[model samples]
Target: MNRETLVNALLILGLLAAPFAADAMGEPFYVTLATRIAILALAATGLNIALGLGGLVSFGHAAFFGIGGYAAGILATHAFNAEPLLFGLPGTNQMVSIWLAAVAAAGMAALLIGLISLRTSGVYFIMITLAFAQMIYYFAISWPAYGGEDGLSIYVRNAFPGTNTMRPMSFFLIAAGLLLAGLAFFALLRNSRFGAALQAGRQNEIRLAAVGIAPFRIRLVAFVLSAMMTGVAGALFADLNRFVSPSMLSWHMSGELIVLIILGGVGRLAGPLAGAIVYVLFEFALGGVTEHWQLFLGLVLLCVVLFARGGVVGLLAGRARHG
Candidate 1:
């Protein structure tokens, strides 16, 4: 095990240990906090696929995240009310069903968004994505069926096969498991042929095209896959809060996801997890200290950007070697 591997392993172990330790000490709130870190990390991991590998600076990922949240909220609402979703498709309280719905909905949205946004590059791409996200955000706010601006509430947590998801520990384990799976997927993707092509396009699109590779399709697929992953995280988040609102679709949420990736280590496999841990801890500790905690947070982010370009993981693991 090299330094990077060791650090990554320690980070995951620490995340797992912290929650269990908190639960053992009867500090359920901390378990919830750890779960938030895992969910946010999962969302950031999705963004990392596009941003890190494909070099796509998508500023509208919140659209997918919100879509997933709404999927959960709407599905749970229909199930609670014993109503059928469109076309006689009954609402489901099952976590598997809700996750499938979330992934499908978000994937479709990503397809449309990627088809249009992928045509542009650089700042144009970023702005186009952001614009699309804002459109959805406004739509969510104006649509009153599911509480609109106030957001929709789920009366009960979604059922996850045999597991007592109502228990904080159980839910944390589920979220943690997903996070681990996501990390593993990310690592595999990074080493696969598709990952190679994506990174090649990121480095030199002209060269990739010369080799008969289509950068556009590769990027679009990456974007859609990224959206699907983030969407799943959104479903988990809604279950954690038992609420879904337009706020989930806001640009701020998108920005925060990017921040999580950057803070952890932009292209590093464990970047999202590292960043989420630091971010959540900062939020918890600073909020308790002062209401104007954002000011301090901004300063810390500035330092990371200027001095710790590699993020927390980068700082610990050394700069990654590019081929």
Candidate 2:
């Protein structure tokens, strides 16, 4: 097999392996960290679809991410309190329901945001997206009904079919499975006709337009799809932490997701996983020593940008072959 393909295979296997090893070693904390890497990788993978494949650099993706978190938090809270949600809808503590709600909420928000923001390009696009995210962040902070700045907490981990989600191993498997699915989707999308048009529009919008394809629609769809994936990750993330807060919607969160894409290798399918693995491990390894660990991380990012433009996976796999 080719290097890129082999690297992709090993990355997936390694992600699952680490969690299993951690569980075996009685280091459940490490399993949680591995799960965090998988969730962040999934979130960044969503962003890569728009940023890497479509060249749509979104600076406000955290809006969708936060929305997903809130979806889980709200549903679980209501279920725990034995209260019905709006419109007399019953609250659910099931992961299946929470995930569906997260996807729906993020998808709707993405649609509305894309309708307006996709009209602009370049810095305007980035700023508008960032502005939307900040607006959401402020809204969450002011909405005291859900504890405002204190955030909402999930009293219990949501249930999944026949799985004990409270177990670190089980939860890690769910996150890793989703991460794998996201990667598979990325591989398929990158090879499809739609993906070709999306990439073409990124290269030359005028030519793409001349070919009777509307770049805006394709981008909008991609943005919404991307949001859905990230939303799911957010739901999983909230469950992992057992809380949802405005911080998830903050511009800093958006920036971090972008940083992950850059660190991993942008468009490469396994790049987000590689980036997440490195980023999380670095944080775990150095966070206790200094509060300014980010400074060091920034230097590493500079090296990646200057020396390894394709990202971590790119460094190991040579270069992407879009076949």
List the lowest-lDDT window of 10 residues for candidate 2. 314-323
Model 2: per-residue Cα lDDT over 1-323, one tens digit each: 89998998998899889878889889999999999999999999999999999999999999999999999999999999989899999889999889999999999999999999999999999999999989999999999989799999998899999989999999999998889888899889988998999888888999999999999999999999999999999999999999999999999989999999899898889888998998998898889899888999999999999999999999999987765
| lDDT by residue (tens digit), candidate 1, 56-142 | 999999999999999999999999999998999899999989999999999999999999999999999999999999999999999
Ten-residue region with minimum lDDT total, candidate 1:
314-323
The lDDT of each candidate is 0.95, 0.92
Candidate 1 clashing pairs?
none
How many pairs of residues collide in each model? 0, 0
Task: Give the Cα error of residue 174 in candidate 2, in Å.
Answer: 0.7
TM-score per candidate, chains pooled? 0.99, 0.98
